[model samples]
Target: MSASTRSPKLRVATYNIRKSIGTDRRRRPERVLAVLRELDADVVAVQEVDRRFGDRSTALPPEVIAEETGYMPVRFGIRPESLGWHGNMLLVRRDTEVMSTQRIELPALEPRGAVLADLRVGGTAVRVIGMHLGLLGLWRKRQARAVLMCLEALEDPLPTVMMGDLNEWVMDGGCLKLFARHHHVAAPGPSFHSRRPMAALDRIITSLDLRVEAAGVHLSPKSRVASDHLPVWADIVPAGPTAAAERHHVAQSPLI
Candidate 1:
């Protein structure tokens, strides 16, 4: 099969919903859901879906999200009331099959967490790491190293993606350097401080098995006010059997 005649494309996105609170200081779950509907991503890694205080319950209940967006949380009730662990959540389209889900603990100055989900996207196994790293640069670097170690321990190295609010300002150096060495850090443009939009805090890093065809920040009337960060999306095609064969063939060919 030719590159143009492959399976349907998959869209993955990451967003920090700010606990469903808009920049206007209104906690409206409906508005956040509206923006999500517009994004229409197949796999979504969300941060700040839960409140900071009290029981850390979900701002938008799982049931409400299911009914409104047809997106099911990868693993519901990580805590009795919380939809995710340490404000990191994963949502997949109803069609995607979940192979496994696990919570990752990191060395952090503050309470921070990451979620790893093994999913089947159009029959292709894909691994997703959703995380919100610490604030300080050094802490962020340590957190990134922890995440890399976790990925290394996986039994099967599937087409993996790591994404979410990394909170790192410098692009070339800082926390991204280690991960960028092995993974493709997507530059989806500036997505933070949704109103003015100056920094690219939210990011997606992928392994070589997946090819990013298109990527950008999703901005709109609802997104502008939905949260402090804008959602970032990427359209990717898995290196399936046909694509893999094509790659092998190219590598073996010596003559021009």
Candidate 2:
């Protein structure tokens, strides 16, 4: 395909917003939105969007996210009123078409879960999973294995992206090794402890079918103080002819 006809780059991000609480220990959803606007990702996997106890209602409610950043939160959680389960949330650009969504029940020492959203980006089907793994080394490995098992059970083999705070402070080894065997585990630089950032705990792993063009941590004045963990983003291009055709179709469609 010609350069002009090629599909535009798709930006994906994963952020552990710490429930919109900043380093100063203040809950500020507006600050979170400001950081997100600066990231400007097409799809974002967010962790800690809701409270851990009680009704589990949203900290950054869906309506607010929609109104502020023009992003639609993928609906999936045990609690109907909650934005996400285990504090994991996924958001897509308003233009994205969400085909289906579900929750992945993982066996862990603690209450751990994941959210999956099958979406159409430029009309190309892509499955995205947002999760927060367990803390223990053994549980973390089990959680990662369970996630891989869930992917293997899918009927169709579509391009998939797995993202969230893995909680793996050590970047080289640990549970991530299992994913590295099959997928491209992205290291978007250090994103943990938003104050003195040193660990690459947050990650964006992609299937072999997708092409990763760029990946990095979003460090800005607003992002630095928005939460305890910085946001990470990736620029990707869907592979194969279908992605190209769909992109052309989307581009040709009239603007609203």
Candidate 3:
């Protein structure tokens, strides 16, 4: 098939719901669901969806997700009521086929981890990694490398995308640099401190085989108060032959 005739672009997004606790200190899962509906992304990487204590149950229940949004959580939770592994969850549109899923444990001072899913969206086959890295710079760097190693070990080389609350503050150094060495790191603008975002801690990174067409932080009245961090999204497509030739050139310039 020709480049123009390939599958339609896929919309991917990441959000840190802060365990459904908004800036007003209210645990409203419905408000988070409203923000997800606004994003309308084909694949969403969500962080802090579960409570930290007791059973670690999900703040945004699966039943609510299925009924409120056109997406379904990719089940990777060991606990029956949790929606993800270590508060990191991946949600794909209901029609998308989930071929396989894996829970990746990262090196961190805290309990940090990532979730990987191989999915078939429309006619395109892609791999999506959702994670929340540690707050410390050293641990973030190590976690970044660990996630890359996991990708390298995977047999199938699908157009890959990694998205989540990365927790790295600096725009050009540390974990961002480590990921930039192997992938096209994209900062879709500031999404932290949602009331007045000044930190681009949330991010979306894509492999060279994929081209990011459009990207930005989703800002709205509801988004600003739904969580402590806003949502970020990227529209991507498989890089055609011509795009593949310019991969190196684009890789040098991170923001897309």
> Order of candidates by TM-score, top first?
3, 1, 2
Off by over 4 Å in 3: 1-7, 242-256
* Candidate 1 TM-score to native: 0.90
lDDT of 1: 0.86
Tens-place lDDT digits, model 2, residues 117-182: 898866557889999988888888888988888887777667789999999987867878877776
lDDT of 3: 0.90
> TM-score, each model?
0.90, 0.89, 0.93
- lDDT per model vs. reference: 0.86, 0.84, 0.90
Q: Which candidate number would show the highest TM-score if scored against the true structure?
A: 3
How are the candidates ranked when ordered by lDDT, highest leading?
3, 1, 2
Clash numbers, per candidate: 0, 0, 0
Angstrom error of the Cα, residue 113, model 3: value is 0.5
- As for lDDT, the candidate ahead, 1 or 3, is 3
What would the per-residue lDDT of candidate 3 be over residues 1-256, giving only the tens digit for each residue? Answer: 3333546799999999999999999999999999999999989999998888899999999998989998899988899989889999999888888999999999977788999999988878889999999989999988998898898777766779999999999998989998887688987999989999999999999988788999999999999999999999999987788656565465445331
- Model 2: clashing residue pairs? none
TM-score of 2: 0.89
Which pairs of residues have clashing backbones in candidate 3? none
